[model samples]
Target: MTTGRDILRVTLRRNAGAISAGTLLLGLYQAAETAFPIALGLIAEHTLRERELGSLALSIGALAVIITTVSLSWRFGMRILQQASVTEAHRWRVRVAACGLQPVAGDTDLKSGEILTIATEDADQGADIIEVVPLLISSMVAVLVAAVALGLADVRLGLLVIVGTVAILSILSVLSRRIGTSTREQQARVARAGAKVADLITGLRPLHGFGGNHAGFLSYRRVSTEARTQAVTVATANGVYAGIAQGLNAVLATVVTLSAGWLAFEGRITIGELVMAVGLAQFIMEPLKLFSEMPKYVMTARASADRMALVLSAPPVMAEGRGRPSPGDDLEVEGIVFGGLRELKFRVPAGEFVAVAAYQPGAAADLAAVLAVRVPPEAYAGVVRVGGRELSDLPVAAVRERLLVNPYDGEIFAGTLRSNLDPGGTGRPVAEAVEASMLTDVVALHPEGLDHGVRDRGANLSGGQRQRLSLARALAADADVLVLHDPTTAVDAVTEQLIARNVALLRRHRTTLVLTSSPALLDAADRVLVLDGGAITAEGTHRDLLATDETYRLAVSR
Candidate 1:
């Protein structure tokens, strides 16, 4: 199981090689940087000791030039590393997004909002490692360079600096493990809170109707507060680790200075050499500090990568068939058996209007899903034939291209009426679809008509209006076979009757399937299939079923 983190690491390694090279150059630059301060101390001491003014002045000038050159190289090298990190992070984000779209046919059990958060927040967090970790490694190399230079000035001071750095890093390594644990906990809490909030927002209308809106709000508030507290805990742990690393660096710097001064006083080392040794020891602390912080950041990224991997690995609901079916208008479900529609068989001629009126509401919805190939036959044994061939053997893309399923709960995005009606903009005009759906009344009421902007999920529209808009969208698609589930469920009896007549008239020469319990719709159907206990128990005209079938009459009478 090579995880998403593995993918991220491989991606970073491939792209951040340039950063590593630049960081190596920076390490060398730091060594040169350390040399300048030593050269200055020597020039000053020499100027005081034997009255060699010219030699000391030249040494000072040479040291100044070296300092300037090293600083420039260091700046450019860091810039290259920074650019490389950013590029690698962006690449990883796109790659992950592409991969996530795979296995799209299954009930991934992931919410849209959660996926959004993962793509934007978790993806970026995982990429942050590329930016910070490389620099931290380069800083460690800088510390090593300082240690080697210190040895040349005083072996004891060099040993002390190395030992102190090792101790601090070891402590940080232990602290990083704790931070990793806390970070994982915090991420989980945040995800849970996000999921709760998304559900509440989506179902806000239902909650209000039930007079439970306050309770739902309180529940979400509790989850949010818990998530916040966990985040603060993770932050506190990180802060403590950083504070310890910084404090250790400061302490080591002071200790090195005092030791170097004592050694100079005892004549064990020259004043200029002691000053240089102290400066190099203090330089050692900076890189050591960066090295200590890298582990925690890398750990946090790993945790987020693990979470994303779970979604990336989910099983898809349906799969693309191996063979492709020829494009045509004919559609059939042979021996199709599922949740409520079982052992059911039906067909829509190449160009004809066929309405499906089921006694069971669940059977109707389930049958529509099966016919649309939204649900897999593998879960519930069935065979759907499109264009006179088994749908299982037909490529899903080809099937979806000609077969459109207009779900009863279809969503409307926040956009102008024209955009919402033709989201795909598949060359279908808005005016024609609205007319076909009998939405002229709706447009007449709106001053903006086609240009009217809808709120999120068409919150501004009534239930019946939203249902009609969804129907308009399906009409706009102009697919060869259209499977509609309760298209007039939200409308009044008179409106339902009108829509039933209008729909049958508009789609007179097209292959159409409607799942309905309404008598008006059944009466308009060429044939009605009675589904009971997930099976097609009877088949006849609407009037015949009303005369003989008790279940059929009771189901549709309401």
Candidate 2:
């Protein structure tokens, strides 16, 4: 759904059956409860005024029946309502998770940690509307029943109860707006704090290397403090709202009770009627209290639903396409203008090994993001083609099957070493890939070899090992058009040379593009293109460029 109202609206529609059943049952319970005091007033009147034994016994029996109805209806009604609510919450959690994993990146301002909170706490709160609606209805049923009973005794008593309830609820609704604001702010601030904590943990290794751990912690502390302050504000607002609602409800009860006694004193009402009016007035306060509190619950639920809406309503990253790339794998780009690139163009013919050295920072990153489909098509100006067909015109699945882009910092999930390398469980022999990426050493050292356990993000592995593992995973995919972005940056000179030569051999007869300035990888490429000044300035073999171009030599030497 696109908005908080939509989420609530749809949830209600989806669980209408449960809500209806629960409301019916709870209404029966409330009717039974309202009758209890009225029944008592009747029993007291008959036993005192008439002194008829049969009448007293019959009144007592009716009271027993009312109590039993109250117990059974309440037990079954709440069970159904709560179960449906839990199930709805689970569905929302899954929906949020799926949105995050979708290929099209949505246009949303929420961070990963914020989404996490939405999927958990916000989802649960949003589903609370399921319970809130029914209970609110049930509370109204009780109030209406009490009003009717009190009116039978005295007209003023019933009118007083009705008007008092409306006034109390109206005042609460206005006051709850402040509570809503505070709740929204509190949730947002808490989500921000969570996001910062997640970032710090993800980059803890680098923070220690650069001695920025203290700085990171300090930044997180600021966010956490803000969250705490917002929480306190929400608590204070709720406190004030509840206190005022309770006071108003008590005042209404007192006024009704006094009015009933005054009527009896004037000899305008019978003794039985007086007892019933006083009992009904006191009992009405319970429903009134519950009804007044609903505004606060609804406000909190709406705020959560709105927080969830931010992610659900974002625009997709890519548009749908019906076309597909043609036969053969050829990498081509023409007149692309994006992020530090101006009219830049290049082509890697099918079955050719090509390397590009972009002298400017973020140039390779931009190219990789575009080629890998990490960027939305509308985000930049470019024509990137594969197999003589435009990437934008082709379907997302077709493009993915035709091309693969291996980034510098690939994610390494927690699993067995083999599972990390071949996440899809293709069962394709990854021995060649392992050897080519120089990851065989890590496997052999653990004795478990490919079955060795891998910590999340390869935390147990050294930097170079993680890099090789990433390369090995990419090589195992064996896509037709593979783009490697600085594939061997972390290894030593000798290991880098081996990986470079092995990648060239392993990827023979397939289109390969290496975006790197590393001399070892450049030397292994059949051809090298030098990117400078937003365009290709020179093209030749690595040695040919090194011997002839001073700028190329200086860049590669570093």
Candidate 3:
């Protein structure tokens, strides 16, 4: 459960200046609006008694005008607050993205989708308090204004109304505590369900292949049902709190009316005073409801705040170490080791084709990650040097700019073929890259060509097509060095041969690292590095390794 102080802190931290001013203006307008009804009741009593023509009519008209002005002001103030809250949400989302993009050292575990959910969903919730809190405070002011009007009518009636209002408010406050707990639990359940659904959908193919559809779907259904149940719990609690508050207000209204009538009968107050007290009841009831409703809103807002905090608090995946490396274009990995790879050293000339075959594919994948600067060199015990400079010693952005690594599982985002092939091209020509990646055949087969629309993650494209499109994207990047992991794994042998040949031709003079067990790709490489047990056990041509290295032979064996 979140406290009032926590919700206030989040609102102020996000948009303090705008929210504070909006709240003050709203409170002032509500105070005036609350007084309008009482002023109308007094005017009515004076008109009936004295039958005044000019003065009474003018006063009543002026009060009506004031009520109109207050209504307009409240509307405009609400607009300003809503706009400010939305702006705060937008700014918070940008901050979340900035934090997520901080060096990988501190952000590895943060999922992109999770950050998106936090920024939009959680931030919106946190901002909701900006609109709700001021109205809640104004409601209390309305209740006070009613108390003052009722007091002028009859002291006993005023005391009864104030005490009853306080009691109703107290009940509301108690119920609000329960609201916060339920809201927090509900939000957690929803987030968990969202993450699970996303994971299940993304890995649907693998799950189906493993024949775990029934079990996986059943588990997902269970999680979904749990989330629904929590939502129902929250809704039930909110409804009960509202019902009780409304019921108490009705009871208070009856008690106040009966008390006012008793006072009038005893010759303690006038009939006009009885009418005034009845009129004040309506004013007090609405604000009472508003005040009561606020706690539930505040509770929801706090739950959202906590969710946003989770995203903000996530650490980046990588850290920038001290010192800067000299800028250059060569690629080198000294004492590189991770996963199955032990302490190994290797360097690629500024423009060369190097193929690596590892007995354990995980070792090759880890080494590729280290070489591409995706995984920190420190995670293993090594130095990955680019352009004769250690990668860790250079800014991450600069390293990323000079190098491109396209893993086999790279996503093909929903977009036209042109957008998928050349995302950052900004309408630049992608024909060369498409042709070089042998995607000319793919385009020729499609009537839409580069304009063909791909579904999310290329659900519309075949596995091999997705891989080829990924390769085309990398080719279009025109990076200095490109590392590809099992790029042709999903393609047929004939297609693989064509892609392998095209990849080598396209990257003729560029520094390219291909992690593969394919003989065709290895045969095209200028040199082959055989990874066995852990370290690079042999370095030679593809033919040489096949003849001399038992581990490489076994790994490359069909």
Candidate 4:
């Protein structure tokens, strides 16, 4: 429930010390820079009044000290600011990444690409706010100090400097608001384009096979073009802002210099005061320009912070339970109705192998998600219990430890075969699971065996190989209740048969549920349940259903 402003406050508080130190140093640097011109004026006056080498050396020495201070202060100030900015970004990235990993209680509005962008680019932009505050403070300190020094030399000149600075900042602030609006639009458009590109890349192979590659490419092209247009608009606004800032600064500096020259001609002020006034005017521009640009950075940071807050504030789809589940193998669903399932009732006794062949493809996936605890209990009507314990009452960790639901399309990360298979590195032997999932051929093909490299999402492997590898990974978990959806769909009939036999043998005396229409898997089950129209229409052996049920036969034929 935290707001974007709260996020900004928290970040600033966390990095306050570093930010303060940097700001102090920057202010000192600006002070030293302002002193340089004053020193030059002093040198000029002293040269005219004393005409002594000793006096000239003292002034030159003072100027050298000022120059050194400016150099050192600027270096340390920048170091601190940059380090703080990066560290702040790292904190946000870690937080956003952790939030993304949590289970959502409902549908998520964010896409994978958008989440990635938030974690990286948006996080960095949010952190940049830490520098903005300090820079603005230091720039103001420089401008105010210059104005005071100018006033000390000549009252009118000092008033002019102060008035001009305020006017310039006010004009830029309005322009900066426009830039802020455009920048936010640009960021959103870029994120949309990024999401489209990511979708295209993830489904590239399938798109090619379906001859839909051109359509996807055209879609991405349209989104990318929009992003480009937005980017150009942002750039144009920024360019105008920068040009105005520089032009205004130049105009103000010229006015001050001309006024000082006229005052010296009128013999109203000494030559040294005139020199100092002109130098102060020129020096003021740097800080004035920085002051004018601060508003834009602040606005951009606010937009980025808002995006980050959206991700961090999302509610978890499933709440964690504190109660433990009983150690029993029985899984029962009584009158469950959710998504594509309606009034579905079923039970698989301890150590029983049951298959639920859903007529609709989406129904099977929805059923798997429900069993996997991916959906919250409140979303469904009835109850799912493990070992006679209501699933909602049992701790999520406890249920997950005992039951595993492997989806049809599982992700394969970039790593060696062994690492992907045994990601937890629990030291469980993979040989058994490998053999059970019929991945022996895949392992044998690579000379390195399980150590063979896998590309991202297993892109280097074939469809069958990827499916088998995923199956092997699931089997390797060694959970008590394993539910698999279409585990062998991508494999050949002969391989599927072998896999079914091996899976039955490996999981003998263990509770298992296979949600599939694969004949080999259905035949291997001790009992098969025909689920049609969101209900279990029939329950019998695979052969009995095929022989007596025409609807079941038609479904399995596909």
- The numbered model that scores best in TM-score is 4
Name the TM-score of candidate 4.
0.93
Candidate 1 lDDT over residue span 242-273, tens digit each? 99999998888888889888888999888778
- The superposed Cα distance between candidate 1 and the true structure at residue 360, in angstroms, equals 3.8
- Per-residue lDDT, model 3, residue 27, is 79
Q: List, residue by residue over 1-558, the lDDT tens digit for candidate 3.
A: 333355458667767777677777787787777667667766777778888688687877789787886887788789888998888777767876776555354443435556666677877887787888778878887787778778887777778878988788788889999989988888777777777776666667668888988888998899889989999998999899989999998888788878877888998887677777777776677778888788888878877777676656654445565555455567887886678878888888978999988778888777767766666555778777878777767667777778788887886788889988777766534777787667888899889989888887777676678888888888888788888888888778877777778878888888898889888899889999877777888899988878987877777866
Off by over 4 Å in 4: 394-398, 446-452
* Prediction 3 TM-score vs. true: 0.90
Query: By summed lDDT, which 10 consecutive residues of candidate 2 come out lowest?
Result: 100-109
Model 1 Cα displacement at 131 (Å)?
A: 1.2
Candidate 4 clashing pairs? 104-317, 105-316, 105-317
Clashing pairs in 2: none
Cα displacement (angstroms), candidate 3, residue 157, comes to 4.1
lDDT preference between candidates 2 and 3, better one: 2
lDDT of each: 0.76, 0.89, 0.77, 0.89
Q: Which residue segments of model 2 deviate by more than 4 Å?
A: 49-64, 102-107, 264-275, 412-472, 490-495
Every model's TM-score = 0.86, 0.88, 0.90, 0.93
**Which residue pairs collide, candidate 1?**
105-317, 106-316, 106-317, 340-534, 342-534
